[model samples]
Structure formats: C-alpha cells, structure tokens
Target: MINQDHFSRLNQYRSMWVLVFFDLPTETRKDRKAAILFRKNLLDDGFSMFQFSIYLRFCASRENAAVHIKRTKSRLPKQGKVCIMQITDKQFGMIELFHGQKETVPETPSQQLELF
Candidate 1:
C-alpha cells in the first residue's frame, strides 16, 4: 500500500526550475534602462544568472512558479519578448551543455526543499 506521507514527500522532490529568457532592446537609453531594471528585479526575486539575458530560479510548486512569472511579466520591457518556462528537476538534469572551452553544470541549490 502507498503511504500518503511518503508519497507526498517523494512528489515534492520533483520540485521545479523556472527559466526566464529575454531579449529586450538595448540600443537606446530607455531600452538599456529597462533591460537593466528587469535584470535587477530578477536578482531581487532570487533568480540566478544562467547566461547572457537568461536567468533561472527554483520554485517549490506550481503556485510559486506562477508568482515568479507574474513578477517577471509585470516588469517586461515594451520593445522585446520574454518567456518563462517551468520544468521539473528531472528534466533540468537532462539538459546538455556544449561550449568551445568552458565547463558549467546546473547549480547545486543552497536552500532546503520547500514544502507547502
């Protein structure tokens, strides 16, 4: 028989990864300011820089993911498009990395898994 407590805990381990991708215009003063502000907001909200114009954060659940997405959406610049993706930790682990001479792996989270 399935233990409800064990099952719930195992399910929470799946967790999630929130990826924020954007390409806001940077040619004009206003555009540049908007871009910088967006970056700052992401950092303020706990996202880590994943690459140029890319950021990521770990979300505890679908609701948490929604909150982050809403925050990102509220700050989106007018000149470009931005996308927020939510993926399970298992899927994140499957991502492949390829670069000319650089080695990087998914970050090891410093916080404990959140349960709510």
Candidate 2:
C-alpha cells in the first residue's frame, strides 16, 4: 500500500517556481533609488538574483506562490514594466540556460521543508 509519506513525496511535481522580471527606469536619481529598493524587497522576500533584472523564489505550492506574488506586486516600482510568472517544478527543471555560447544548467535550489 502507498503510505501518506510516499504520497506526499510524489507531490513534488506540484511545487512552484516564481520568477520576476522587471525593467525599471534608472536614468533619474529617484528612479534609480526606486529600482534599488524594489530589488531589495525581492531579496528580503527570499528571492535570489537569477540575473540583473530577474529574480526567482521557490514555493512549496500554488497557494504559497500566490502569497509571494501578492507581496511582489505591492512593492512594484511605478515607472517600469514588471512581470511575474509561476511554473511548476517539473517545467522549471526543463529550462535550459546559456552563458555566451556555452550551455549551462540552472542552479537548483535546495528543497525547502514545509511544516504545518
């Protein structure tokens, strides 16, 4: 018989990856400060810099992802384009990355344990 623990382990496919991409106007001093502050907020929320304007965080489930997305929206800068996307862990694992002409694998974050 499949146990609850085993069933729980099989649900990893439902895990989520939240990605934020932004292009903020940094020409003016105020614009620059806002951009910096936006980035800081993402970091404070446990997101890691995936690139200059890309940040990502892993969430255990869709509900958890929604919480982070809402937090991100509340802190958005006023004068730039920002996009937030969520994908399942299975989809995220299939992404291919490149550095210049060399292909690279994305760094997989350590699995986070969820405690009820």
Candidate 3:
C-alpha cells in the first residue's frame, strides 16, 4: 500500500504529463475487449487522450502518477503490453522531440540531432 502522505506530497505539484504506450500483439476478441475496458477506465479516471497511444496531461504530482499507473496496471488484462511514463517539464529537455518522433542524441551535440 502507498502512504497517503506520500501521495499528498506528490499531488502538491500542479502540472504533469503522462505517456502511456500499449500494444496488442494480435487483434483478437479478448484483446479488443481489454483495450476498450482500459480506455473506459482511463476516461473515468480523468485522463484525456493526447494521441492514439499517449494519454493525458494535468496538474498532478509524481506519487499520484505512480498510483494511477499501479491501478491501471492492476486492472489491465494479462495478455497485452502496457507502459506508463511520467514526465515533468523539468525533465522535458533531457530528451528532445523531433517532428513527431523521439530520438536519443547527446543533449549537448547538435550535429547528431534526429529530425522527423
């Protein structure tokens, strides 16, 4: 169980972004059902869809993000793949975003930059 104080502290931060990645190996009845359920749950929990695979951005803290991820993972069907990543503006520049892609390049080097 997570401590309520920890959750509160995390929640004190006012802004956050949550990125969720999910993939279904094969389109099957079970997979589809699981996907639908996951989507519904996310909506119910106040996460807005940012992209087909990305989720919401809101004024939430890290602990809240962790709790949300934990609950989501617990509810997910065992057959699919799901990953939740929480990033803040503070960590934003640690990575660079291309036209619509993410590439790993040295933060200080401009020559090796990858562009979309």
Candidate 4:
C-alpha cells in the first residue's frame, strides 16, 4: 500500500488521471441519466474535465486516490467502469514530443519522459 507521506510528496507536482468508461445499455434515457449523474458527482467533488469523456486530472496522491475511490465508488453509476492512472513523467514527455515545435522555452527536467 502507498503511504500518506509518499502520496503527499508525489502529488506536489503531479496528478492522477481518472478514466471512466460508460457501459450503459442501448436505452438512450438511461445512458443520459447515468452520464448526468456521473458528471454531477465528479463536479460536486471538485473534479474538472480534461476532455469530452475524460475527467480532468486531480492531485491524487496515493492516499487521496484511495480515499477518492472509496468515496466515489458508491456514487458512480452502476453502468460504468472506472480506471485510475498515475501521470508523472509520461505526460511531460508527450507534451514535449507533441508541442516542442510550438513551445519557445525548454522543458523542465520533470517534463522529460519516454512515455505518456
């Protein structure tokens, strides 16, 4: 298990990427309700959106991730799946690899990575 202290340190500069996959049936109304409920819960909990389907990354220390999962599990729609990914080095690398031409300044040490 990840300790609270380590978790805190890790989150100082990085965040956790949460990916939620909706598995609703063909029923349009149920799908809409589930999406609304899911978004509401995340918003109520202060989670931002990174993309249309992906939620914004949060400062999810190991401790926070655990707590977040525990707290949100029950509130999440039953017709969906949740995934948590820790983004530290990889995200930086991707930014550099993709945005290097557009960026004028050099990337930070922490921003250099082989994978995102």
Best by lDDT: 2
Colliding residue pairs in candidate 3: none
Model 2 root mean square deviation, Cα atoms: 2.6
- In candidate 2 the C-alpha lDDT for residue 12 amounts to 65
**Candidate 3 per-residue lDDT over residues 16-94, each given as its tens digit:** 5566777754488777887888878887766777558666544245666677777777777667678788777345435
Task: State the lDDT at 66 in candidate 2.
Answer: 93
Q: 94 in model 2: Cα distance from truth in Å?
A: 0.3
TM-score of each: 0.80, 0.87, 0.59, 0.53
2 against 4, candidate with superior lDDT? 2
- Local error of candidate 2 at residue 30 (angstroms): 0.5
The runs of at least 3 residues in candidate 1 whose Cα sits more than 4 Å from the true structure, single-residue gaps closed, are 1-9, 12-14, 101-104, 112-116
For model 2, how does the per-residue alpha-carbon lDDT over 4-56 read when each residue is reduced to its tens digit?
A: 98666566677889999999999999999999999999998889999999999
- Give, for candidate 4, the lowest lDDT window spanning 10 residues: 107-116
Ranking by TM-score: 2, 1, 3, 4
TM-score of 2: 0.87
lDDT for each residue of candidate 1 in 1-116, tens digit (9 for 90 to 100): 99999876665556788999998888999999989999999999889998998899987677788888898888887888898898876677778776767766767766845545
Off by over 4 Å in 3: 1-14, 92-116
Cα lDDT of model 4 by residue, 1-116, tens digit: 99998866665555544444344343688878887887788776655664466554344345555565666677766665665445543353354333545754433322212221
